[model samples]
Target chain A: MASTEQEVLEGLAEIVNEETGIDTAEVELDKSFTDDLDIDSLSMMTIVVNAEERFGVRIPDDEVKNLKTVRDAVTFIQSAQS
Target chain B: MTSSSDTRIVVTGLGATTPIGGTVPETWEALLAGRSGARTLEFDWVAEYSLPVHFAAQIATPPEQVLAKVETRRLDPSSQYALVAAREAWADAGSPDIAPERIAVVVGSGIGGVHTLLNQWDTLREKGPRRVYPLAVPMLMPNGPAAAISLELSARAGAHTPVSACASGAEAMGYAVQLIRSGRADIVVAGGTEAAMHPMPIAGFAAMQALSTRNDDPAAASRPYDTDRDGFVLGEGAAIIVLESEAHAQARGARIYAELAGVGMSADAHHITAPEPEGSGAARAMLEAIETAGAALSDIAHINAHATSTPVGDVAEANAVRRAFGELAGSIPVSATKSMTGHLLGAAGSLEAIFTILSLHHRVAPATINVDNLDPEVGLDVVRGEHRALPEGPIVALNNSFGFGGHNVALAFRSV
Candidate 1:
C-alpha cells in the first residue's frame, strides 16, 4: 500500500510509536529500533506484524531479524513490493 | 531476629490481594468481620459457555485498576497479581537492602495466563496471525508471574516457579524455606497467584464437576463442613510472604510476622482428582509439618483447614486431621477459610499461610462464614459465627493445602 520508501518508513513510525510509546515525529531512517529508539524485542514483534499487515508484505521471523533500523524496514518493504 | 540455631527461618513480611480486600490489613479486617467475597459474574462468557457455576469470588480490587495502563497491557492478569502482592511484601519488609544476588523469587500458579492464551488464540483464529500479540507466549506461560516479579526486583540469585496444582503457592513458600536453609539466598519473595476467572477454566471445571451450582445464594454457597455443602467457589487473587533467616531479619531489624517454622509435603499416590478418601496423604503432610517444626501435637493451638466445601474433601480432610493429631484433633479449632474467601486455587495455600501467620499475631481465630448445620460426620471443632480470641502464650498453627494430582502440603507457623 505504501507507494514509496519514505511512505513505508512514515507508516512504520506510527505503528512503532503506538506499540512502544516512542514518538513517531522523532523516528528516522538512521535510528535503530533497539539502540537509538530503545524499543524492546516484544515491541519489535508488534512492529513486524503491523508492517506485514499495512504494507501487504510477508516479513517472516528470519527477515524480521535483518530489519534493524527504520531504513532497513522501509527498504525491505519497498524492494519486496517492486 | 538474631538466629541462635541453624534452621531458624522467620517471616519478615506479608501481603495479599484477596477476595475480601486489596491489602493485608483490609483482608484481615474483612476476615475478622466474617464477610463473604463471592458474587455473580459480570462477564458475558459465563452465559456463553453455559457454565453451571455462574458466580465466583473475584478480587475486591483488581490489579488492572491499580497498575499502570501499559503494565496491565503488557502483563497478564496472573503476572499483574504477582507484581502487586510481591511489591507490597517487599515494601512491607522495609524494602530490605540485600544484595541482588542474595535474593530470590518463587511464585506459583495452578493455571497461568489462561485468559491471555484463550483470548490470543481467539484473535488469531478470527483475525489472522497479524492480530496475535507478539508477547503472547511469555504472557501465557505458567512461570510468567514469577519471571515478572524476579525482573521487577532484580532477583538474580534464582527465580523459580513451582507448579503443583492448587498446592503451587504453598509449595513456593516451602521452596523458599529450603532456599534459606540451604544457604541459597537470604531473603526470598515467595507466594502464589491465580487469575483464572475466564470461561475456558470455568467450563473445564464445570465439565469435571468441580464447581458448586449454587447460582441463587452465592455468599452461602461455600458451606464447608455443612451437611449440604456442594463444591468450591472458584476464586482469583494472590498472596505473598517474605522469608528470611532470623539472623538476616535481626541484622536489619525487620519486624517479624511469625516463624515459617516448617513445611510438610506428601502425595496420595492414589487418585489424581479425588483426594485419598482415608486422607492418608493429607494426614502425613500434617504430621510431617509438626515433626519438621519439632513441635508436638499439643503445640498446635489452631488449624486453617483446606476445606474447599466439596462434600468429599471436607470429610476427608477432617479424617486426615483426626489421624494426624489423634484425640487432640477434636480440641484444635479448625477454621475453614474458604467459606469466606472462597477457593483461590493456587493462591489458597499462601493466602491461608498469611491468615495462619496473622491468626498467631492477632491472638484470635477468624470464623468460618456459613456452617448453618454442621455435618455430624465432621469430627473437628469448627470455628463458627464469631472470631474467637486465641489463648495467651506461644502457640503454633497449621495451614493445610491439598491440590489435585494428590499433592498435599502443610505449613506450620509459630508465634514469635
Candidate 2:
C-alpha cells in the first residue's frame, strides 16, 4: 500500500542536519551516520520515529539496532511494509 | 569484583518537579501530607483525542515559567524537566566545586519526547518537510535528558542513558552508585524524566487496557492494591538526586540525607509487557539489593513499591515482597504512592526513590490514597489514610521498580 524504499529514503533525507543546515544527500546514504553524515544516535532515533509514523508500523528495537546502513533501512522498511 | 567496603555512596542533594510539587521541598512537603496530585482533565484537546483515561499527574507548573523562553523552545518537555530537576539538585549539593572530569550524569527515561516526535510528525505531514523544526531530532531522542544534564554540568566522566521502561530511573541511580563505588566518578547527577502525556501514548496504553477508564472520578482512578482497582493513571515530570562518594561529601561538608546502600537489577526474560506471574525475578532483585546493601532484612522499615494499580502488576509485586522479606515483609509498611501521584512510568522509580529518602529524613511514611478496600491477595501492611512514623535510629528503605520487558530494579537507602 505504500512506496517503501523511496519514501523511507526521502523521509530520512528530510531529517535536518544540525550543523550543516541542509538535508542528508543521496551521496551520503552509504556513509556512516556518525562519521560522515554527522548523524548521531539521537538523529537515528528521530529517523526511526518518523519512519514508524509514516508507515504506521512498529519497528522492533532489535531490528532497529541492526539497521546500520541506508540500504539496510530500506530493506527493513520494505519488509515491514509487506 | 569490587568489595562492599570499596564503594560508599551518599545522597548529597535532591531535586524534583512532580505532580505534587515543583521543587524538592515543595514535593516532599506535599508527599508527607498525603496530598493527591491527581485531578480531572480540563484541556479541550482531551475531547478531540477522545482518550479513555481522563486524569493524569501533570506537573503542577510548566517548566517554561521557570526557564528562559529561548531555552524552553529548543528543548523537549522531557529535557526541560530534566534540566530543571538537575539545576536544583546541582545547587542543592552546595554546587560542589569538583573538577568537571570527576562529575557524571545518568538521567534516563522510558519514553522520551513522545510528544515532540508525534507533533513533529504531524508538522512534516501537514506543513511539509521544509516547515519541520531543526531541533526535532535533539528534542525527541531518548537520551536527550541525560545528554542535556551532562552538558549542563560539563560532566566529562560519561553520560549514560538506560531505557529499561519504568525501571529506567532506578537503573540510572543504580548505575550512578556503581560509578562512585568504582571510582569512575566522584559525583553523579542521576535520575529520570518523562513528559509522555501525549494522546498517542495514552491511547496506546488504553488499547492495552493498562490505564484506568474511570472518567467519572479522575481523583480516584489510580487505586492501587484495592479490590476495586482497575488500572494506573498516567503521570509526567522528573526527579533527580546528586549522589557523591562518602569521602567527597564529607570533604565538601555536604548535607547528606541518606546513604545509597545498594542496588540490584534482574530480568524476567519471560514476557515483553506482562510481569512474571510468580514475581520470582522481582523477589530476586529485592533480595540481591538487601545483600548488596550489607544490611539485614530486619533493618528495612519501609518499602516504596512499584504497584501501578494494574490488576496483575500489584499482586505480583506484593507476592515478590512477601517472598523477599518472608514473614517480616507483612510487618514492614509499604507505600504505593502511585495511588496518589499516578504512574510516572520512567520517572516513577526516581521520584519514588526521592520519596523513600524523604521517608528516612522525616521519619514518616506517606499514605497511599484512594484505597477504599484492600485486595485480599495483597496482604502487605500498606500504609493508608495518615502518615505512619518510621522506626527511629538508623533504618533502611527499599524502592522497587518493575518495568516492561520484565526489568526489575531495587534500590536500598539507609538513614544517614
Note the DockQ of each predicted structure: 0.45, 0.03
| TM-score of every prediction relative to native | 0.92, 0.83
Candidate 2 Cα lDDT to native: 0.86
- Which candidate should be chosen as best, given lDDT against the real structure? 1
DockQ for candidate 2: 0.03
Per residue, candidate 2 scores C-alpha lDDT tens digits across B288-381 of 9999999999999999999999999999999999988889979999999988778888999999999999999989888998889999999899
- How close to the true structure is residue B158 of candidate 1, measured as C-alpha lDDT? 95
Local accuracy of candidate 1 as per-residue lDDT tens digits, B1-416? 22233568899988899999999899999988889999999888787867788899999998867887567878899999989999889999999998898899999999999989999999999998778998999999989999998999999889999899899999998999888888888999999999999888888887888888899999999999999898899989999999999889988999998998878999999988999998999999999999889899999999999999999999999999999988898999999999989999989999999999999998888999889999998999999988878898889999999999999999999999
Which 10-residue window in model 1 chain B sums to the lowest lDDT?
A: B1-10
How far is each candidate from the true structure, as Cα RMSD in Å?
2.8, 10.1
For residues A1-82, could you state the per-residue lDDT of candidate 1 as single tens digits? 4468778878988888767767788799999888999888878888888888888888888888888888988899888877
Give i-RMS (Å) per prediction. 2.0, 7.7
